[model samples]
Target: MVTRRRLPRAFFERPTLQVARQVLGQRLVRLEPEGGRLAGLIVEAEAYVGSEDLGCHARAGRTARNASMWGPPGHAYVYFTYGMHWMLNLVTEREGFPAAVLVRALLPTEGVEVMRRRRRGRPERELTDGPAKICQALAIDRELDGHDLCNPDSRLFLEAGPGVPEQAVTTGPRVGLNSVAEPWKSIPWRFQVRPEYIPSLAEEEQTP
Candidate 1:
């Protein structure tokens, strides 16, 4: 078992880009109600800093849906989109400052059987390769919106995991924002672990 230390609130209270970069290779664990822990290594994430960034949810100002983003650091900021899918984000920065890191993809580690089952036998590659898909695989929804990720006793939390070297990290523009304009749209806020550095199951083979 990977003896991962739960990340502290200070880990998230750092600058948005730093949080996004450091999050890669960290463990995202969910204490499943029916089984043991369902966990995965965070592989991709995007940073949204403050209300000035047009792509951030705070761009439209704080509402009931995005209030969590403006609250304490190291909290879940889950939101529903496409009328059906849920996206997971981590709140960053000090209280009242709206900065967040969107977890874009994960590489299944522990309790993959449970995740595969929840995904209804979808191919391993599709299991948690997208933001909405990760939520589906972990059964996260609006109820987890304000959950504290820094709490050791929480059902869901982040932990120190596989280390990703600088050579194995990549950055690019955040995706799925075709409607947004320049600067923000082109900012290279997306962080990902290179394929070669990921575990074999994630890139070299299909999930069985």
Candidate 2:
């Protein structure tokens, strides 16, 4: 049995950029009702800083929809996007900073069989490699919003996992945001797993 270690609140009460870069290779654990456990290796993430970041929700100040992002760190900031999918973000920085780290991708590890079923016939490569895809693969949704990431009792939390060495991690510009101006948009904040573990979706068809 794997003993999960919930990350301390202090871990998240820092700069979002630092959290985003450092969160690579951490374990994202989900506790099931049947006392079962599901986990995956965090492979990709992006940082969004306060109002200064035009791409961030905080740019509009603390609205009802984004109030959680303005709260203390170590909280989940789940939000719906494209009227289709829910994206999971981990709030970071102090109470007023309003920063977060978007968990962009994960590599299925524990509970892969369960994840495959949840994917509902998606290809393995598409299983847990993107934000929406990972939420689907890991069964994360709006109900999990505002949950405490530092609480062991929370349905979703993080833990220490296999370390992805610096060499195995790659940094690049974040996906889907081309409008933001220089420096911020060009910042290589997005991190992904090395090419090896990332599956080749082109080579396989979805299994039904």
TM-score of each: 0.94, 0.88
Cα lDDT tens digits for candidate 2, 1-208: 2345778999899888778877877789887787777777787899888998877889878887888898889999999889989899999999877888999877666777778888897776678888998888777888888888887668798886654667777888878878877777777878776777444321121233
lDDT of 2: 0.80
Winning candidate number (TM-score)? 1
lDDT of 2 at 194: 79
Q: What number of backbone clashes does candidate 2 have, counting pairs of residues 3 or more apart or in separate chains?
A: 0
Give me the runs in candidate 1 sitting further than 4 Å from their true place.
200-208
lDDT of 1 by residue, 1-208 (tens): 3666898999999999999999988889998886588888899999998889988889999999999999999999999999999999999999999999999999987778888998999988889999999999999999899999988779999988765889889999999978887799989999999987886424432333
RMSD of each: 3.1, 5.2
- Runs in model 2 deviating more than 4 A are 1-3, 197-208
